[model samples]
Every structure is written in structure tokens, then in C-alpha cells.
Target: MWNRLFNKKSSVQRKILVSFLGLIIFPLGLFSYASMSVSKETIRKKEISSSLKTLELIADKLNIMASDLTAISNLYFANSSLYDLLKPPQGLGIYEENAKKDFLIKTMINYKYAYTWMDYNTTLFGKNGFELHTYYEGRKIGLDSIKNEPWYAEVVKANSGIVWVSDPSPKLIPTVDDDHFVSAVRILKDFESGTMLGIFLISVSESFLYKQYGNAVQDYEQVLLIDDKGIVISAPDKKMIGQAISSFGERTNKLADESGHFTTKVNKRNMLITYDSVGKTGWKIIAYTPLKELYADIGKIERLTILLFLSVLAISILVSYFIARRLSIPIQRLFTSMKKVEMGNLSERSDVTGEDEIGELARKFNRMVSRIEDLRDRVSAEQEMKRKTEFRALQSQINTHFLYNTLASIRSMLMIDPPEKVDAIIVALVRLLKKTLTEKGEFIPIAEEMDNLRNYIRIQEARQHEHLRVVFEVDEQIMHLKTLKLLLQPIVENAIFHGIEPKPTPGTVLIQGELSDNKVWFRIRDDGVGYSGFPPSDTELDITELVLEQSAGMGLRNIRDRIRLHYGAGGELSVISRSEGGTDVVLSIPAIMDPEELKL
Candidate 1:
């Protein structure tokens, strides 16, 4: 089936159409694919890079806040008054003790005002049953309760240094509000004696964590702070603050890297996760962006690329079609003319006009058909008159003269022209004479006829001393098509001698042939001196009238009679005098390939 579909001969038009489509569509499709791939990766990388940078910034800010809290703790450790006040109160007057308590409360209030930005609550626990609070004033739980707490042990183990407690339990921070908080716990000690005094706790509200990077969070994105234990210390969603980070995703374990980014599924949704370590805190600042949201721009680009590719493809197809039509239509016209000539149309001429190969073929076809008509007429007259012997002698004499003239032309070229060109002209003349004298067939392929015409033209070019240009435009389709022999040479002879030879300057003879309306039409136009009496730009005229009015030569008269005898009313001959000082000769004949299809 494939062979059957593809085996048929393709027309020039179809081949051109397919070639143009391939040229445009293949490259366009490849370019579109490459651009989409590059653009997708580039956009994804750029977005990921930007997200990682933001995560790093969030980590840096958290480090800064942690440092500030540590600095505040150091201040408390340096204050001798704080150490003395936090130490156990010795036996003394009740009023004195009360005054000492008042002094301590005032000092705490002063420190709160001094660092209002920290927005932290402080609790001081003396060795005695004394507890003093700042914001959580009602929480009077004793030192025994604090020592029993899980995080309290972690603080004591720090050996007088500060310890950060994330996701603090309610018992550790018995505040009036239900808001979550993280605490910085440290031992208050005497600077001089190095004696431990009391435990100091600074509880930072959840607002502190959110406020640090709240504005950085976007829709469908998560910003989280996870403690060393992988506990969610801070997050946009308050409920998630105390939960294990692993609850978000099993792949969260990959966050073990000090700082990096990866793609994973979180809560069953694909996510792009970027993490950075908070400075010296053993905690991670992480950004979670849904992959869908992260690559949304890439999606848009994909759609736009497809749209552009389709648009360009559509335009390419349109342009290719027009180009193919332009290139193939002329060939089709020429093919039609060849078909007409093949059908025994002795007067058939191609009307295709151009300096291109196809145009040259048309001119050659027209000239060949004219020569055939003239030969047929001569043959018919000779038979009627019963003068075959005399006619043969006369034709031999004509052939001798023609060969003599060509030899003279070649001899003249040897002196002024190059040896190679003279040699080529000699070869052309030999071939032209051989075909003319030796070929006996009345009808020959149009291709052979055009080849003979080419040889004749080459000899003429070498023969002419002046600038004489001849252009023949004929279609290739008619090359193998049959036509009467010896058609083109005589007309070309007349065009050179009668038309171009008279012009003083350079001149051009154009021969064109094409098919129209089941008939082959040919035109021979020369930019040279035209005949005196013919009307300028004549489209149609009777051959007999042209012969009488213009006193046409025997060659023209014979060709006209032959066309009439062979093709009846379908054969046409016209001679026009151009307004621009030239001559236009046109010939046409019915398209009939088979002898039986002929009117005769």
C-alpha cells in the first residue's frame, strides 16, 4: 500500500510544495522544542535560586535575634544587683525584705523598658520560696516546680551558661495566655564568687518568631524554623509550632544537610524545599514552595511557545503554497503545450515566455513545429508536382550552402575568438548538419529538436561579430513529446537575417512556447528592425492576408500553407510590428498526439 501510494510520478508542483513544507516546518519544530526545554530549565533554576536566597536571609535574621537574646542574658549575668536580689534572702526585718522585693521588681521593669523590642517575659526564681514575674505575674510556681521540668535540667546542665528551649511546655511557662512561646534559660550567678544565685527565664512570644520572617511567606509556601531535635519551633501556622518536622514529610530527613535545596513531596503535594542553618543555633530555617506554584511561570512560557510555534507554522505553510504555485504553474503550462505537439499538431507553438530553461524549451518547440509544417508543405507540393528528383537536388544544394556558411562563420571566429570556443562551435555545426541531413524521421522527440536548436544557436553566437543574444524558453515536459522535425532552424534564420541583422547595435531574439486551451502556442519576438506594413501589437491575423499585405517570403508562405493543410482552422500564424521597433511572430496548432486524432 505504501509503495502504491508513493509510486506514482509526482508533479513539479507537488515536489516543490513538499520541499517547502519540510524546509520550514522541520526547523521550526526543532527550534520550538529546544527553546521550550531551555526556557523551562532556566526558569526553574532562577526561581529556585531566588527562593534559596530568601531562605538564607531568613536564617541570617533568626541568628541575629538569637544573638540579641544571648546579649540580654549576658547583661543579667553581669549585674551585681540582679545576683544579690536573686540570691536567698537572709533572716532580716519583714519591712527590709519587702523593700528589697520592691527594688528587684523596679529593676526588672527598667530592663523591660530598656529592651522593649525583645517583647520577652522574664521570671526570676530565688533559692527560697520566692518567685517574681514580669508579664506572667500571676504565675507563682516555686523553684521546685522549675527544677522538676524537663527543659530545666537542660538549663542546669549548661554549667552557668544560657540554654535555648524551643516549644516550651505550659508547665515550664505558666502564662495567662494560651499563645505558644520559646524560652532562653540561664543560671544567675555572683560574678566575684562564681556562686550560683537563681534561675532566670526569658520567654519570647510566638509573635517574635512570626515577626522575624512573616512578611516573606507567600501563598502555597511555608517558612519554618526547626530546632535541633527536629521540632517545629516557629511556623506560619501556630498549630504546627510544637509538632515534629517529620510529620510534614518522610523526606524531611533530607533537611539534614547544613544548607541546600531539593524537591520532595510534603503532605502529599510536590514541593521545592530550601533550607539554611540558623547561626550556631543547631536549627534550620526552611522555605517550602509547592512545585506547581514555583514553576507557574514556566507553564505560562510553555503555552506561549506552543502558540508561537503554531502561528509560525501556519504562516510558513501559507508562504510555501504560494511559492510552490509560482514555480510549478509555468511548468504545467509548458507540459500542456508539449502534449499538444505530441498529438501531431504541426503548427503547435508554446507561448511560455522567459529567459529561463523552460522558456527556452518553449521557443525551441515553437520553432521545431514551424519547421515541420514547412517541411510537410514542401513534401506535399513536391508529390503533387511529381518533381521529387529536382526537389532533392535543390534541397542538397541548400544543405551545401548552409554548411558552407557555417564553416565560414567558424573560420572567422578562429582569428578573434578563443580556440576552445571555435572548437565547440565546430562541434555544434557538425551535430546540427548531421541531424539535418541524416535524420529521416518526419516526427521526432521535442527534446532532440531542442538539442538541434541549441547547436544551431551556438554556431550563430560564434558567427555573429556584433552583440546578438538569443533566448529560448521551453518546458521540459515537452522534450520527449513528439513533433515534426526541422521546424525551428529556418525561423531562427529568418529572425537573425531579416530582423536582428539590420539593427546597428546589440539585439535580442526571444522564443517562447506554452499550451493554452488544448492548443500549443509559440511566440518569436526580436528587438530589432521590424517589417514595414504589419500592424503593431496584432494578436491574430490570417496567414494569407499577412502574406499578401506584407509581401511575405516563400518560406513564410509555405509554412502558412502547411499549417492550414495540416491543422485546418486550429492552426494560427501572425506577424506583428512592435511600436518599440521589433517584430512578434506567433504560431498555434491543435493539440493532437495520435495520427487518427488529426483532422485530415
Candidate 2:
């Protein structure tokens, strides 16, 4: 089945449609499943983290409330006036005793109003019985009525400082009903003797706990407050309060961590459980949420992903058919054209046209056929031209030998006459001809080229007799560097014939050479009639066209072309008709120490 599906006999459209469906559907389905799994886990973790944060916030508020109650109790114990009232003179009269009681009652009332968390304030004097101050008024209770209370005994037994106790049973007090309270209890001592004088108690209602954590209860199915002894101190179901946490499920031991979250099953329902401690109260706030309820959105996403995959599979079939047709038609046309060209048909061409890669291939194929036809037509003509050029070059070599032999004969004749001035001229001419005719190489040292230029200048000066002045400013370091032969002499000859000869006064030709940035530079400036018999123009003038237009243009053109051919783009020649009554020809070429280093 797989071989039949992928066989070459299948149409392009069918193959593309099958391939596209396989590529798109398989990965999309796999990715959707993976994404759904990751998203489900992410939602579970985020919900647990959010519940833990809420639980921690409620625990912090509870701790702040406890700390506030403890601070108020400390303030009362530090009050000297309260201490004086509690320890009255032994023989005080009724009026004075009554006055002290009134002062003490006023102080206690003020404290109850000052600290909102403190619901009831009470003091138990060792001898004077207990005084209770609620929001409304003061009352006196006999020592026997409250001394036997469970928290009272606990506070007395742990006698060094303040002790916190959550009343297991709600005690009825005036101005507050049926609500249990968490109390801060401390012992008061006489300032002078450091002896225990009384017991201090500040109690806050348990309804404060519900108010602080009420928002969190709405977010979860059940919220429980459990103590370290595995006892449920508070619960959403009021009847469950004061019961052991094990009664709910098997989660009592996991509350040892200060703050954490976990997943557990209780009564056949999976639940996410989060808990945090409430200060040092040995009590923890635990929130429980059912997993099914928490992940309701994930179910919807799974269904939507299935629907999307089906829609994408249908769209891919239609798109892949048209795309495959568009690509395959051009390729088929290109293959036909290639076969025609293979059968010796050079004019065959592909009509494919677009900006895509297939279009570019067809265009290149057409250009290749045209280029081959052009080469076939030009082959015979190039052969004929090559034969003529070689014949002329051979004849030119023979003429060079004949000229050298003629100059040697003249030198022998001049030695016989022995005229001093004529001998110098003949010697200079022979040196110039030998440098030009001998095929040592195309490149020579700058010093040797300069020597040839000086020899030509000597012959010209001897003939013209003070009509021309030449100046050489060559850097010693660059004299050994190699440059093209005959590069400077032609320009010097053009300057003498066209520039210096035309001027009525004697003209100076300055030849300057320098080395810079791995290139050799030459500047030939003549103080003669400049371009068009005026000072040179500043605009760029094409040296090739300008040289061709002159009477001696061939020499200048030959020099420029030779330099360009040898150095390619690295060689440059420019003619700058100077503004100061002269013409300057600047030439630049790559600096080389030997002829073999020349690229050409």
C-alpha cells in the first residue's frame, strides 16, 4: 500500500495532496494533544498556587491580630497608674478605695476602645477578686467563679509570662454572645518587689477569624482550620468544629509543612488541597477544591482542537492540488525544451515566465542556447584574425632586430670619427633603442625606466638645444620597485611634440614618482600650452577619447590599454589639464618587486 501511494506513476496532484495531509494532520494532532496536556497541568498548578497565596494572606492577618492583642496586654502591664490602682495602700478608707477603683475602671474602658482587636479586658487581683470590662460596663466576679476555669489553671501553671489559649467552649460574656475567643494572658508584678500582683487577660472574638478568611471560603468547596494536634478548630460546616482532622479523610499528617499544596482523594472525589500556618498558633488554613470542577475549561479546548484539525485537513487538500499543478507544469515544459536542445536544436526555448526559481531556470536555458549559436558563427572569423595577428607580430620582431643592427653599425662608425658630442648622442640613442627593442619582459625596475626616459630626454634636448627642461623627483625607496616598460616615455614624447614645442618660451617637464599604499604612482606635468591652448579644465576628461582626438593619440591609447590589460582594474590613467598653465598625466599601477608578481 505504501509503495503504491508513493509510486512515480501517481499524478503530481494526488501525491502532493497525500503528502500535505500526512505532514499537516499528524503533527497538528500530536501537538494539540501535547498542548492540551500541558495546559491542563498548568491550570491545575496555577489554581493551587493561587489558593496557597490566599491561605497565606489569611494566616498573616491572623498573626497580625494576635500580635496586636499581645502588644495591648504589654502596654497595660507597663502602666504605672494601673499598677498603683492594683496595689492600693493597706489602710486606705472607703472613699479613697472607691476613687482608685473609679480610676482603674476608666483606664480599662479607654484601653478597650483604643485597640479594636481587644474585645474584652479583665484583671484578676490576687486579693481583690476579678474585674471585667467589656464594651459596655464593668463587673466584679468572685474568685471562685472563674479560678477553676481550664484556661485560668493553664495560665497560672505557665506563670512566667503571657500565654495564648483558644477557648474550646464558647463562654457567655456581657455585650458578647455565644462566641469563643482567643485570649492573651499575662502575669502582672509589683514594680518594687517583683512579686506577682495580678493576672492580665485580653480576648478577641473568634468571629474575627471568619471575617479575615471569609473571602477564601467562597473560592473553595470547603475551608478548614486545623490545629497542630490534628483538631479542626474551625470549618465551613459548623458542626465539624473541634473534631479531629482525620475524620474528614487521611490528610492529618501532611499538615507538618509550614506551607504547601497537594492532591488527594477524599470520599472518592479527587481534590486539590492547599494549606498555610497561622503564625505560631499551631493552626493551619486548608482549602479543598475538586479537580473536575477546576478543569472544566480543558474539556472545551479538546473539542475545539478536534474541529480545527478537520477543517485544516480539508483546506490543505485543495491548496496542495493547485500548488503542485503550478510547479509541475513549468518543470515539464523545461524538460521538453532540454530534450530538444539535446537533439542538436540550438533554437529551442522554454516559454515559462515568472519571478520564481523555475522561471529563472528557463531564462538561463534560453540564454545558454543563444550564446552557443553566437560562438559557432564567430569561430571561423576569430581563427582568420588570429592568423593575421601572428604573422604581423613576427614581421615586427624582424624589424626590431634590423633596427638594433643599424644602431650598432652607426655606433661603430661614430667611434671612427670620434667627435665627442656626436658620440654622446649616438650612445644615448643606442641605449634607448636597446631598452625599447629587447624583450627582457613587459615590466622593469623604476630606476631602469627612468634611465631610459633620461636617455630619450638627452637625445631630444641635444636636437632642440635648451628648448625643453626636465626635472626628476623620484623617491629612492621606490626606484627598485617594478613598473610597466615604456609607460613614461610615450607621455614624455607627447609632451615635447604637442605641449612644449607649441609654447614660444622654454617649458619644463616635471616627472615625479612615489610609492604609497602598495601602489606605484607617476605624475608627468609640463608647463606648456595646456588643453586647447589654455590652462587645464577642472572637469574629468576621458583620457582615452582625449588621446584619440590628438595627432599622437595612438601612443597614449596603447600605453593606457597595456596598463589596464596587465593590472586589470588596479591600474589607472588620468589626464588633469592643470589650471596653472600646464597639463598633468597621472598614472597608477600595483607596486611589485618583480615582474613575476604582475597578475597578467
Candidate 3:
């Protein structure tokens, strides 16, 4: 059933419609759906991963800040002046004691200058009952007040090392107005005696943490920093700080992993939360986005997909319809014309106006039939011309009787006187007659043709008592080249008879031959009565009629016809009157050398 519907005999319009819908539209629709689904999922996953990476980077910055504070605290504890101030006085004067206090104060001030993050630093000497603080004029702090502080006690209990204390509310140094600080405290010990010297505290502002990590949270709908105890240490909302993590919902529990994302409810709104842990600090950075906002573009993409599919479907249908008609109409016309041509109607033609392969085929077919018709007419014309030429040749044979009459005259002269001049004349006439009668071939060597020309000129000069002066200017290089026989004799004859015979004085006839480019040329010029009827050099003349009528030379006309027949268009003959009251005939033909003649 499918084959019947899709067979080649089916209408092209139906075939095109079915093919476009099945092969193009179907696959395009399937691919668009699959790509939309994959693109949505890929974009969502990539966005989640990018948010997690940003959180991890913020965590790294926090870890670095903690390490910096720890290093600064350790440096301050190892100062020798702190140990000296803690040691027993050893009978020193109050002046020296004050000097040492001044040195310790200068050292702490230098620490504050070097570490910009350090908001305030203080030291308590247990033995000397003196306290030093970075703020305040006296640089003194009451030891009793901090001695009972939990962080202070924790540092002393540790005794031999540093302790980090996350203080929600730190007591401000006497004149320092900051109430929130993250403190690193360490117990100072005498290096030689292992005696407890003092307690050192370095407090960093909590605002510095927010300032460093704030940009990471800017892109999220909401962000929070939660400690291991599930307390919100920092948030975009300052009031949210110090609140229980449960206020944000159970999503905080999922943040126990190093980094992750999950869909959950936050304040009764759908949210996607991504979180990353902040190293060993027991803190995690969390970012959240509302689901509706995150996938807002997906809805637009779905709408666009449907619109694009419909646009493509409509365009494909139109294109398919036009393309089917464009191709089928020309083909149908060609097939119809071919049927006509098959029935022996060669005049039938297909429309070849379109610019396509089918149009080209139609043009080629028309050209083929035109060429066949041309060949048939040309063959018929050639047969008719051949018959006419044979008839002319037969009529031209009547001139041979003149040769017989000349032979008879030569016989009579031989009987009357056997003079050397007469014998030479008879010998020249015999050679000319032998060549004209015996040689039936159309082509001969240029050297042989020149010999014949010399013989004919000799006989003519003898008859005219040497009144005609014959000059030969032949290039030996082209003497062996073959050309149409009797080509030059006729031109030479016209030069002597019509050109020189009418002149009162002795006239010189020049026969010159040369090879140039790929052609052999001969020019016969005579100082005789110039023929004014000669055509211009560039004009194409039918030499048969031109020579026979105006030049009154049958030999010239016959030579022209033979040259044209043998060499086609390449052979040419032209006659023009020379400015010096003479005539010049130029003959040109392709140079074909005989190999056997070359050896001779």
C-alpha cells in the first residue's frame, strides 16, 4: 500500500508534500523537542554548579583571613620585651620600667599598623599586674574585667598554645567603639623557664568578614553563613545573624556535605539552595534562588520553539510546492516534445528558457537536432558542387588540344632547322607538356612546381623572343615543402601574357617563394599593364569568378578553385595592382613537407 502511494507514477505534488512532511518536518520536530529538553537541563545544572563554585571561593577567602590572624598573634607572643616586662624587676628603677612599657606599647602599635585587619590588640601581664591596650591614652586595661571572661580563661587553660574564639559580643577596648570582634588569644610563656608570662589577644572586626565575602552573595536571591552549631553567623539581613538555622528551614541540614544543591521551601516559596563548607572553620556559605525566577527563560524558549516549528513547516510546504512545479513542468514539456521528435518530426522543440540542468538538457537536445539538419543540407550541397566541379574539369580538358597543336609546331620546326635554340625551345615545351598531361596528383613538391614554372616561362619567352624577363627569388628551405600542383604556373602565365605581352618594352616577372610562421607563400609581380579590377588586399573574393572575369585568366581561376578544395580556408589568393604600373598576385597555403623529397 505504501509503495502504491509513493510510486514514481504518483503526482509530483503529492510526492513532494509527503516527502517534506515525513522526511523534513517530522525529524525537525523530534530534534527540536529533544534539544529543548537537553538545553533546559544543561543550563540549570551549569547555573547550580557556578553558584557552588562562587561559595567555595568565598570560603577560601575566609580561611585565609583566619590564618593571617593566627600568624600575627603568634608573632606578638614571641616578642622578647613582653617576656622581660613579665619577669621580676631585679631592682630596676621606675624609669627603666616605664621605658620597657613604652617599648611594649610601640611594638603593639607597630603590629596594628602592619596588619590592617587587626582592629585592636591587648596584653595582660600576670606577674607585674599591668595591662596594655592598643587604644586609650594610658594604654592600660583592667586585668580583673578580662580575667573572668570565658575566652580569656580558655586561653589561660590551654596555657601553651593559641585558641580562636568566635565572640558574638566582644568587650570594646577603653576608647575603641567596636563591639563585635573575632578574637585569637594565646598564653605567653617564658622561653627559658617555661613560666607563664602573660596573655595576648588579637581581635579582628566581624565587619571585615562581611566586606570580603559580600560580593559573592550579591547575585543570589538570599545568602547566609551558618556555623556548625546551626546558628546564622552572617546574612544579607543583619538581623538574621545570630538566629537559629531552623528559621531558614531544614535546607540547612543538607549543607552538612562539603558542597551541594537542593530544591526546597524557604519562607513558603520554592527555592534552589546551593551551599559549600568553609574549610575547617565549621562554617558553610549558602546561596538561594527562587525557582520561578531561575527558569523564567524556559517558558519563552518553549513558545519560540513552537513558533519556529510552525514557521519552518509553512515555509517548507511552500518551497516544496514551488520546487516540484519548477522541476516537473519543464520535465513534462520536455517529455512531450521528445515524443513528437520520436515520431520523425524533427522540427519539434522543447522550451529551454529556464536556467537549470533540465533547461540545459533541453537546449542541448534542440542544438543536436539543429546540427543534424545542418549536416544533411551541407551533404546535399557538397554532392551538387562535386558534380559541377567534375563537369567543369571535363570541359577544361578541351585546352589539351592546344598542347597537341604546339607539339605539332615543334615537330615542323625540328624538320626545317635543327638549331640549338629551336632544340632548347622544343625540349622546354616537351617538359611542360609532360608535367601538365602526365601528373594527375593534386599536390607536388614546391621545388618540382618551380621547375615546371621555369619550363613554362622558357617556352613563353622563346615564343616572345625573350621579351619577358623572369626572376626567381625562392627560399631553398621551403623548396621541399609540398603544395597544390600547378599553383604558381597559372599566376606566372597571367603575369607574362596579360601583364607583359601588352607592354611595349621588356617586362620583368618576379616569382618569389618563402616560408613564414607555418605557411608557404609565393608572390608573382610583373612590370606590365596593371589590372585595375583587382580587389583590395583584405577583401575576400571568389577567386573563380574574380580571376576568370576581370583578370581574363582561366589558369588563375582553376588554381584558385584547386587551392580552396585542397587547403580549405587556410589557402588564399589575392591580386592587387602595384603602384609602379604593374600587377602582383600573392598565394599563401600551409607548408607541408614531403619526407622523401627532404632526403633528396
Candidate 4:
């Protein structure tokens, strides 16, 4: 056996030690690389997050500046003095081109910008849209001529009380007359008459946001001032000052006010980016870091892990070479014994004699296989016996139930009825017997079952004339749906026999079928002697008598048991009735099955 084991080991192309070593070594190298890469990713995300915080601070300040600008614009547009002056000649407006006594100092205080002014014109279509009237600090120091400015016509053309932010325009400076002052302009007016013949312009420095947030962060990170349209209203970079951020704007349109971080390829390099938005203006702040730079230390760790993994692989191969040989003999015996059992030689046993754990494990395994064989035989016999028991129970309930009752009814009809009545009675009895015995098959179409039920009810009516009125209201669509044989008749018979027969006055026996919620439900109800107040679960009710005593309730117990057996516990025939009125026996069953499955 030792010589054979040596020969087997030599014939193998890949030694077990080498196979084991590669398994341990390869995953270690891969995991080490993956761990370092994940660490790098985490670091990159942290940096981007930190930068995003700084961007948020800048974004908040910029949004506040824009809101404050809007507030001031609204205040100017709502000014009543200016609003009354722009009204039609109702005696409330100023008629001069210069500032009046009441407007002189107040307008100066409100319009604090260097070249701020309120200009007026005789007509909206005048050659100059507006003539400078109330100028702050004089046009000599920092003044602007609105007559020829591109914004002058635009501002005057718009109706008063509306703010408009125009494109960049030129304004005249004090010392340098040609040095244009950049400004945001709007129109001021009266509320009574929507007339506009003047302009309200605020001259602001071009480097408004850049001078404030330009040096707030490092060169690696960016700070942007975005407007409602995601346009770069102001920024440190001259090129990006008025440019739009379409990508960010598009994302904002998709995700409203929610904020998060993401890793995506930007300019062909992987970058970690995080951003947030000012809810009202749709302005955003974005911070980014290069993934490779953030994860550089992780890459170093990955290289060290790979080197360590390779060394471990070598040491493992040296150790496992002798270890694998030591255990190979024991494992070979398991393979041999398992093959014999798989080939139906259940008597075969593993005989790897030893004092260690493997020897004990082999002994237990042999014992377990022996018990498994014994269990197989026992379970087979038990299942066969269970199947027979179920069929016998169903047969007992179906066969002996209505047969003897039909015979007794026939004997009574023969004694009292005439010849013609006897012939009709025999024909109906034959049809009822065919249905009860189910000579056609165990399973019948629902339409056939209804025909059988009509015959049965007719014969019963012959016996108990006007004592019971059986009314059937079956849904037409459910006529072709299949169900178990005689699933409902037993219950209906019980309701009439137990519930309605004892009542003094003739009572209604109502049988209805309908397709509701993909299932067939038949309600056998009777407005008759009603129900017993006794509960089925109560111990005093003699459940054995109700179940097996062949009393009026015996058929109902049989019906319920058959339903549970066929439907595997989900199907049921539950009885619900109201006292002194009617009893309703509900028979619920599945309605559809393929023809092949129906055979089963």
C-alpha cells in the first residue's frame, strides 16, 4: 500500500502541496492589493469631503450676497416717493430733470454705491432713455452717462417695479473718465399707474466675490459662485467668471436639493467629488480630489502585502509538502469507500486505522451510513401506508354517505305516489345515484355537477313538497370551472337536514356559486331552524358524535376533512350561521388547473 501510494503521488502532474500553496498565496496577493486600493478610495473620499466643507462655506456667503442684492433691488422698486413720481401727471410726480427738495438727501442715502443714480426722461421714447438727475458723489468723481449705455434703453423700456440684471455694461469713473464702472441696473415706478420713464442703477465692483473668496482655499480645490441657472456669476479664474456649469446644473435638475459624493472620471482621470446646493437659487459648491494621489499610501501597502504573500506561499509549500503526504493515505480510503457505496455496495466500510481524530471521524461516518440505510427502508414503508390511509378515508366519506339515504327515500315514494309519479321518481333517483356514485369519474365538470345537483334537489322536493325551497344562484362564468367531486352537496344536504327540516313553516334553502377573487365559492345557506348555539371547539359538544355518529352534522365533518386532505390545510369548509334565521356553509376551492395536472 505504501509503494502504491508513492506511485500515485509520482504520476500526478501537480503535487497537492503546490496546489495548496497556490490557493493560499494567490488570494493573499489579490486581497492585499484590493485592501490597499480600498484604503486609497477611502482617503480620496475624505479629502474630497473636506474640500466640500470649505466650498459650502463659500457657497453660503455668495448666496447671502445674491439674496441681499435682490432685497435692495426690491426696496428700490417699492420706494413710494420714486413710485409716485413715475405716475402719470396726477400732480404727485416730479416734472423736472433734476432732484427736488424732498428727494435730494434720501435718495443719496439709499443709493450708496459710488455712481448710483435715479434718472428721469420726459418720455419713454425720448432720444436719451433717461437723463441723470439724482447722482451720488457727483458725475465728476464716479459718474455714468445713461444716455448712450446699452443698459439705459433696456432698463427704461422695462416697466417700473421690476428688477432686471443686464449684461456687463460700461460706466464712467471719476479720475479716469473712460474707465467704465460695472453695474447692475433696474427700474423704479409708482403703484397707481404702471408708467416707467427712469432707471435705478447700482454700480458694484467687478471683483465682488473673487476679492472675498478667492484665497479661501488652496490652488488644488476650487470655489465657484453659481447663479440660479448654474452660471458661474463670479470666480477667481477670469475665463470661468461668466461660464455655465451644465453638468452640475443637469444633475441638480435630476436631484433637486439632495446632496452626496461620487467617484467619476473627470478629464480622463478618476476623481472623488462631493457637492451641495443652495436650495432656492440652485447654486452648487463642488470639491474634488484625484483618486490616485489620495490612495498613494495604500498602493505602497499593496506592494508590501504582495511581497509578504509571495514569501508566505514559499514557506507554506515547504511545510505542506510533508503534511499533505502524511494525510493523503487517510483521504484515499474515504474516496474508495464512498465510491463503493455510490455503486450500491452499501456493505463497504472505511478501514483507515489510526489513533488521531481522522480515525474516530471515519468510525462515526461508517455508523451514520448504516443508520441512513435503515431509515430509507422505514420511511418508504411509512409513506406508502400514509397514502393508503388518505384514500380510504376519502372513499369512506364519499361512498356510504348519500347511498342509503337515497334508498330510504325511494321506498317511501313508492308507498305513497301514483304510477306516473313513481316513474318520474325512479328517473330522478337514477340521475341522483349516478352523481353520488360518480360513475363518470372522481372529477367532473362543474356544469355536469350542477345538472346532477338539480336532479337531486328535484327528487328531494318531491319527498318534502313545500317544506324546503331549494334556490340556486350560480354564476354563469364559473360553470366550466373544475372542482373536487361532490364538494358542496354534502354541506347543502346537512343544512337542509339539520337546519331547515325541524322548522314549522316551510323555509328557503339557498345555494349560490360565484367566481370571486380567482377562486370558486359556493354558499349553501338556509333560512330555517337556524344554528345550534354550541361551538365546535367546546369539549362538551361530543365532537365524536358530531363527526362519526351519522347525525345531521356528521356529513359536515366529513366534508371539512376531505377539503383539508386535498388542499393541504389551506382549503377549508368553515360553517358560519346566525341564530333564529339561517345557516351558511361556505365551500371554497381552487378553480383552475392544466388538463395534465387534473389527471394527477
lDDT of each: 0.74, 0.73, 0.72, 0.61
lDDT tens digits, residue span 203-299, model 1: 7877787888888867778888888888888888888888888887645568778888888887788887888898656788888888788778778
Candidate 4 residue-wise lDDT, 404-472, digit = tens: 666677778888877787678779978776666644545567887888778877777877777889888
- Worst ten-residue run, lDDT, model 3? 168-177
The alpha-carbon RMSD values of the candidates against the true structure, listed in the order shown, are 23.7, 21.1, 19.1, 29.4
Relative to the true structure, candidate 2 reaches a TM of 0.45
Model 3 accuracy (lDDT, Cα): 0.72
| TM of each candidate vs. truth | 0.55, 0.45, 0.43, 0.38
Q: Total clashing residue pairs per candidate?
A: 30, 1, 0, 4
Ten residues in a row with the worst lDDT in model 2? 168-177
Candidate 3 lDDT, 505-568, residue by residue in tens = 9899998999998898899989887554653444333343455676366566667767766666
* Better candidate number, 3 or 4, judged by TM-score: 3
Model 4 TM-score, 2 decimals = 0.38
**Cα deviation of 145 in candidate 1 (Å)?**
3.5
Q: Which candidate do you rate higher for TM-score, 1 or 2?
A: 1
Best by TM-score: 1
Provide the global lDDT of candidate 1 against the true structure: 0.74
Q: Which stretches of candidate 1 lie over 4 Å from their true place?
A: 1-11, 33-42, 85-93, 146-149, 172-178, 189-197, 217-220, 250-253, 256-258, 267-270, 295-304, 333-352, 361-600
